[model samples]
Target: MPAATFEPPAHRGLLTESIARRLQNEIRSGAIPVGAKLPSERELAVQFGASRNVLREVLRRLEAQHLIEVAPGRGSFVIDQSTADARSYDALYRAGRPTVRQLIEARIPIEVEIVGLATSRATDVQIEAMRTANAAMIAATDPVVKARADLEFHDTIAAAAGNPVLRIMLSSIGGMMFEMMLRSNSDPSIAEPGVPHHPEILEAITARDTDRARHHMREHLSLALRTYGPDLDLSLDVMAANHIETLLHRRSTP
Candidate 1:
């Protein structure tokens, strides 16, 4: 088989992440079959027009994710699909990461209260920060930038709430939340309907109407659940099955 090549379009940032994502897709799609050796590091660096150092970092990240194995005397090889699936499940559950459903469920009540607090307590500076984030979200043409701005908008509100404990709690789950947003935004069907709600939430908070703020925030979250609930449930089911299959495979191995 011909060695797979990565050709990213011009002007995309996060070159390392972009390369990893493309390579991952190829592996999952079986374009790079399981146990097949990847192109040599120097060849891949040349193909990707990336520096050797950047290419190495991308390889390292893929190795860490169990998507590929790097052998010192050989080259990187793709892992079997089942093994990759099992590793994903183990990593997520072992690290105590919440599933998408649980993350949204937990965020609803906590962020509703946070929005209410911000409505009452937000100073001009804090409110301006949120406005700035909202503006960024509105103007952002890139999916990653939009997702980040969306999170920042909410995070600014949490900061404006002035509750250290609540801020810390949200911060703890922020990474997972960002991941969820990125997934959801990648699908136009899921993202298009949700755009207006952010501005609505911002308006309510800026008006300093606690009830409206809470109502808008709750509405925003509920709409999200309704929109992405099926996808989230499907993801959970797949992960659970993978976990069970891994356990069964281990038992059978011994």
Candidate 2:
């Protein structure tokens, strides 16, 4: 017997990138946890209405980022997110430095979905743990303390997902996620007492309403993203400008 050759699909539409974006977003959001097998290239192509080639290219890019791995005689497996291979896992955001838009946009969807899943799977003990973490967040006066507490809250929810692989995937970039939250929450709006939304999310999860859990989690994220301060780091844009300026500065310098 001989092995079957891999056949590329025949269609590549302008929508290929959009499909890729949706898939990547899903992976980051933990709708597809780490170490889970993705659909075959042919299946993905059909699903996205693109050619196999485009789907393969998208998977290749994700693989390059260590978001997925392909093996001969097998299918693509999301890298074991639990591995925490710094060399392999790239934090979705660079810590202490990310655009306000980037921070909020990236963090919201992922956390929202995690809460939704948690609503269904979290044990009573898990719910209580999250409440404890939230209490810590509410009591903290310093940025560092608040940040740690916030991480605890989200980490607890991720743990409640009942998937160790999902926790690992969430953990890989978990540090950066908290850092971004702190940065975005520098505004007075977030600093006010009773403003943190973790409690609302925990309440929803305890109530076991997946829809409410998702909604509150999203509201929490939306508030963070919508809130802003003059101190918001525009460094993302600054760095881009500086890179060009430095290149020109060097070009002009005697």
Query: Once superposed on the true structure, which residue ranges of model 1 sit more than 4 Å away at CA?
Result: 1-97, 235-254
- In order, candidate lDDTs are 0.71, 0.64
Kindly report which residue pairs in candidate 2 clash with one another: 9-52, 11-51
Q: On residues 64-96, what C-alpha lDDT tens digit does candidate 2 reach at each position? A: 767788997799987654456623444335434
- In terms of TM-score, which candidate is strongest? 1
Could you tell me the TM-score of candidate 1? 0.62
The number of the candidate with the highest lDDT is 1
- Colliding pairs, model 1: none
Across residues 171-220, which tens digit of lDDT does each residue of candidate 1 receive? 76664566566555545667788777777877887787899889988887
TM-score of every model versus the real structure: 0.62, 0.53
